[model samples]
Target: MIQNSKLFIAAAATLVAAVVLNPTPEQHRARIKEAIAERSPLAGFLGVGALTAFASTYHPLGLASYTTVNDHTVSIGVLGMVFVLQPSKDT
Candidate 1:
């Protein structure tokens, strides 16, 4: 438990530092997709919902997220915390 806490702290700190220095979502193509997706209100709405589900770690919304470290994958958000997302399967 203590080791998991430490890893979570370290990962959170690193994620925050990286974002502060480069405050953008993890992917370049995401920006493009966001631009395209937001053009329609439905897409924007679902995008917001998906983001909320991702943040809240709610499965009913069908939004799943994970990250990989040293070839090991770990959950992020209402599950476990470590690593940033690799890439979205869609877009």
Candidate 2:
């Protein structure tokens, strides 16, 4: 039981670190591509099949945020606190 708790803690910590890193848009795109190439479930978890110019809103209690906009935009909610990935100016 103690070992299991330790393993769970380690997994949670790793996830928190990954989320906090907040991959760049390019990196996010690459991640999606790689996931697809490897046929990983993470592909769908990343987001839409492909990212294109689009508008999205993040509700106060939203779990995740995603958008492809021209100007820089940012939104954070309750669970969003876990994964804070703000949209930057699309170049």
lDDT tens readout by residue for model 2, 9-81: 9998776765555444444344433444355456445654344212333222122333333444332222223
Query: Who wins the lDDT comparison?
Result: 2
Tens-digit lDDT track of model 1 for 9-81: 9999876655444412233224333543455578666675245323432111112343333443323322222
Residue 13 local lDDT, model 2: 79
Provide TM-scores for the models: 0.25, 0.29
Alpha-carbon deviation at 55 in model 1, angstroms? 36
Best by TM-score: 2
Steric clash count of candidate 2: 0
* TM-score, cand. 2 vs. native: 0.29
Model 1 residue runs over 4 Å out of place are 23-91
